[model samples]
Target: MVGGVKEEYQAAQELLTCMGANVVYCGPVGSGQAAKICNNMLLAIGMIGTAETMNLGLRLGLDPKLLAQILNMSSGRCWSSEVYNPVPGVMEGVPSANNYQGGFGTTLMAKDLGLAQSTATDTKTPVPLGALAHQIYRVMCARGYANKDFSSVFQFLREEEGQ
Candidate 1:
C-alpha cells in the first residue's frame, strides 16, 4: 500500500505495478500505516478465533481437516481458516504443519497488536476483540512462544488445557 500526496502516489504507482506489486493508494500520509494496523489486528483476531475453534472441535471429536473444510465452505470461512489454519495436519506448507517455525513470529504479532491497541485508544475506537487478541499475543510472547509462528496459538491453547 502507498500513502502520501496523491500526485506522488500516482507517480509511483506505475513503477510499483511494473514490479508486479499490487499497490493501493490508501490516502494521505500515515493512511497506509493505519490500514496495515487495522489489517493486522483483524488477522490476529482471526488467527486466534481459528485456533480456539480448532481446539474446541478437536475436544469434541471432530477431525481437524473436516472441521476446516466445513468452516471454509460455510460462513465461518476466513483467511485464517482457509489460508493459514492454525491446526497441525489440517493443511500442508503452512507454519502449523511445519511446527510453527519460519513464519510471522508471535513477537512480531504482539508488537503489531500493541500498535493496534495504541491506535485504537488514540482514535477512541472500542476494539474489544483486538484488545483481547493483543493480550493473548502478549501472554504467548511471555510463555516462550516469542520466536514461534503466531499461528502457534493452537499449541498455546492446547498446553493451557493441561494447566
Candidate 2:
C-alpha cells in the first residue's frame, strides 16, 4: 500500500503500476507503515493460531490437509489456514511445504511485531494478543528460527512439544 499526499501517491502509483504492482493508497503519510505494522501483527497472530490448531489436529489423528480444508470452509478460516498452511504436507508452494525454507523469515516477523508492540505502547492501545504474538516470534528467533520462514512456528511448536 502507498501513503502520503494523494497527489504524490498517485504519481508513485503510476510508476508502481507500470511494474505491475497492485498498490492501494491507504491515507496520509505514515499510514502505509501503520497498515503494514497492523497487518503483520495480525498475520503473526493468525499464523500462530493456525499452527496451534494444526498441531492439535495432528495429535488428534486428523489428517492435516483435511483439517485445513475444514478450517478453510468454516469460521476458523484465515489466510494462514487457506493459503499458507502451517502444517507440512498440507499445502504446496509455501514455506511450510518446503520445510519453512523460503518466505517471510521469523526474524523479519519478529521485527514487525516489535514495531507493532512499540506502536501499541506509544498509542496506549491494548494489544494483548499482539503482545503475545510478539513474544512468541521473539522466542522463535532466539531458538534458531531466525532465517526460517515464520511458518516454521509450526515446527517450533512441535519441537516445544517434544521437550
Provide TM-scores for the models. 0.95, 0.96
Residue-level lDDT tens digits of model 2 in 49-101:
99999999999999999999999999999999998998889988999889899
Tens-digit lDDT string for candidate 1 (117-139) = 99889889999999999999999
lDDT scores of the candidates, listed in order: 0.93, 0.92
Q: What RMSD does model 2 have?
A: 1.2
